[model samples]
Target: MDRKLQRSWMMYDWANSAFATTIMAAVFPIFYNSVAANNLSEGTATSYYSFTQSVAVLIVATMAPVLGAIADYSGAKMKFLRFFAFMGMAGSVLLFTVNEGDYLLASILFILASVGFSGGNVFYDAFLPHVAKNEEMDRISTKAYAFGYIGGGILLAINLVMIMKYDWFGFPSSKEATQVAFVTVGIWWFIFSIPLFKNLKEKKVGDPTEKRDKSYIAIGFSRIGETFKTLKYYKQLLIFIIAFWMFSDGISTIIRMATFYGSTIGIGTNDLIAALLITQFVGIPCTLFFSKLAKWISAKKALTLALAVYVVIVILGYFMTSALHFYLLAVCVGTVQGGAQALSRSIFARMIPHNKHAEFFGFYGITSKFAAIIGPAVFGITAGLTGNSRLGILSLIVFFIIGIVLLQLVNIEKGEREAKALEDPREFVKVEVK
Candidate 1:
């Protein structure tokens, strides 16, 4: 079971999640609005930040499948993972240079850093099937989410204190502390990633005997084309991906837009932030609890239960009336968010052709990004038309509903059997290159 190897892979989650917390979620948006966009209105600053993030996401989502196909060809996952991780870390450190009236520079670095973070995760996810056996997938995946919660939560907690009590940290103001927080994310990410690079090795799946003459770039596209044509052989897996896309969109929309919705509706910023922090800490234990729950019941049932909870949460969100209500919703989200996502990853890992993890997880990444845009767009449109955020929040019910319906159609056992039947995994990448 290679406990050391599994832990090393999980540590990468702990490492990079600091970027998710301090840089992406908690500290940076506030810093960007106040310091980077010093002369701009708050609305304008937020708009610019959103635009920059969208740019980063577009680039990564476009590149993911090709990169994944190429990595699968020659045990290149580790190399690619290292390169993108460096990009993310470098961007985080460079954010320290941002000062008042430097929104352009801050935006550029944010785009680069986030691109790196998202790009690196494609390969990091590719390691899942290699690190753990079939029976261990749920435990390993759920625990990784738990590790992310604890690690990211700790750093964010420290950064919050640093900003709140800037004088105690010997900084001139909160801005200086915020800039330093960016550097801390970079250092923390790099230091924790060492264990992964040192301990885990990418298992080679490419065929040396079956040779091809095309450049990797061309071959990457070729591989994807072949994957598309042959996807019918993996029908259950395709159904699962569709289901995942729909539900994950709902989850991402809630995560990305919740604070803004809360702010728009008159909830205090401090209460919103504190409530979110509770989600992080509560997520740690609850995510781990799902691992045991999955073992007790089954991944599919556990995930179905989680999605059912999300439905209730959204309905409750429609009627939410106070800061206290928001806090309760945050707790509800914290309880199921990690479990649903963790189980999704593990379930996908179990279903795909073993040799094509990198290639397929790439698609997983892209679907997630694209689906992410839909919920927010729908929410925005609904809110705009109705002049109420409640209806906007309620609109998310459609995503979860469709996702659960499609999820029930996926035959996981048949999918696993189909995946196991593929022996010569390079049928398209090598011998059939014509």
Candidate 2:
């Protein structure tokens, strides 16, 4: 509940988002398509980028639960977070070395960076409940996303200027300017991370128990089985996770693929990056506004409203043909993208047993990451077969629709009630969270 602690925790979101904006969502996709994959056809390059994203998520999906289990017992969430953050930073810095026609290297580095980003997020998310009380979760989560947008937007704007006007930065060409931007993402991430590591402490993980006979890896695999057995006791929360997987996949795909998809259809790099910058700046206020909306209408209804807007965005993306269209679509997306995700995260945190935050969030991460795989793969394959990425955009409508349906079924009150009567999976003994 301390303001300083909350602000420190949120700063991680601000720091890491630079990489999200500059490397993942905006600049690199265009750079990859035009430079790294220069020799390949547009469709092939897009397909390759999509597949690499899938592979990275898959790898992280496999790792999430085990690390979560270990962190639960060891209270090593911060350690795991530090490791993945470093991995992401290294990947970002290494990206500066890529040269023309180095698509293979680019794919490998992207995969490495993506894994680090998603993997670190699992632990970062686990810290949410620890950082805020139940009542504070929604506000803090949305505020965190707002901070991300602002931090990421500032960096992207600077990078945009550098790439568009290389002479101002003393670069030999825009290519060199773009390469330095990649290094900046790494530097920005590391510098901003200092506050959280220095200021916050891991207060508790779960209730203390005797040391396990098994290794953390072995416990991780066993916990997955045990967690499923416990699912019957918290059905509403399980349903929410399923809904999150469906909708989150769609949300992630749009963020990951939008720039590349635009470039594939012939939008200029500066315009593509510019529109995304608009999304970032617009998202800052909209994310906070949705947090307020969650208070006014409840998190569930607010999230549902956001998902509804996404359906409109995807359909519009299908018909997008000009820079103005992309810019308009970006504005629409900024309005709801962070709101849906931030609300979903807070709602999940409230429903899960507080004693098992890391483990449940781990399961949450793995499922969502695996779900993330389907969207890009679907888009890539759909585009590859049809030879049109716009159709791929059209195809995402089903996910949001399915998610909205499932979300309606979640009874938040019931989930919170079940969480309060916590059951220790190790013994099936009921202990109230207090």
Candidate 3:
């Protein structure tokens, strides 16, 4: 492995996770609720938050594959990554403009930031197969997730302190501190992303025998059509996607809505932020544990264990009525959040043809993004209808249950073999990563 390149790739996680932690999980939801959407009812605020998140992901889901295909056709994966990173960074920085009763502005910026985050992630994930050998995929992927936890956690801790001690920072109120934190996330994200741009090279894409029009846009669409035609040939990979789509939706909803849900039920901001901190700090060690467990048991089994934990967490969430229950639930979530997501990335990387990593990972991104749709939309609908958040939380179990059952039908090794069989013979011989 190229150690520098690998480290560079991992640093992108460190950079972007600030968006995940400070903006997505900890500070912004609270800000959006108490300030931006203060005009709305508690239930409506929660629904709007989830709905905005769903819309952001839905936009990315529609474009992921096409953008990926264009990148592959033009050998411009890094360029696409840069564009989205900037878009997300700009959105993060602009979040400082959101003031009380600025729900519309908040929604627009949040969606833009999310699209940038999710879009950049598609290209970042595609780099996995190019940088790591098949045997090293789990370790590398987990390491990236571990770095994300530590980096995101560290920044969130600082942001928490700033919010707590606003006077020391010369801010008159916690609200000002939070607005500053949004800007801080943008700076942190951009600073950390530099290494990936500097060190990691975009692998050449588009096979020698493949034909395409002069326009990359046309070729991108053609490539997607061809990929669709071949989907049935990779049965295990397809099965894994179906499984991942369901369970990942459940996980994403929990992360995006937990604080809002807690707040809606009368949890204090202090306790909610503290619980997020617990999840972040506790996740550091737990994520590493899953990486080791993957080596011992296999990535698939480790991921299965993580998903099982999620199912348990969702069940517990339904019964949560106090800070203690919320705290315990956060701890449970921390144990599996990174592990499940990282192992899924590695396992999928192993199953796909490396030459088409961007395209396949685009499909991976779409499944995840679409899953974002189902879970949050369901939560929003349930909450809107019943006027209770507990039902919304409990409803996620169906996704996890369906995911676990479908996961059992997938055979990772067989998927990898099938993918390899489809690769160009000469290229396969030149770099026999397996």
Best by TM-score: 1
Ranked candidates, highest lDDT first: 1, 3, 2
The collision pairs in model 1 are none
lDDT against the true structure, each candidate: 0.90, 0.87, 0.89
| For model 1, the run of ten residues with the poorest summed lDDT | 425-434
Q: What is the TM-score of each candidate against the true structure?
A: 0.96, 0.93, 0.92
Among the numbered candidates, top lDDT falls to 1
Report clashes for each candidate as comma-separated counts: 0, 0, 0
Candidate 2's residue-wise lDDT over 179-259, tens digit each? 999999999999988998888788655556666688878877787777777777787898998899899989988987787
TM-score of 3: 0.92
Clashing pairs in 3: none
- Displacement of residue 310 (Cα, Å) in model 1 is 0.7
Candidate 1 residue 218 C-alpha distance from true site, Å? 0.8
User: lDDT tens string, model 3, 135-180?
Assistant: 9999999889989999999999999899989999999999999999
lDDT of 2 at 50: 68
The reply for model 3, stretches above 4 Å from the true place, is: 38-51, 207-212, 382-388, 424-434
Residue 29 displacement in candidate 3 (angstroms) = 2.0
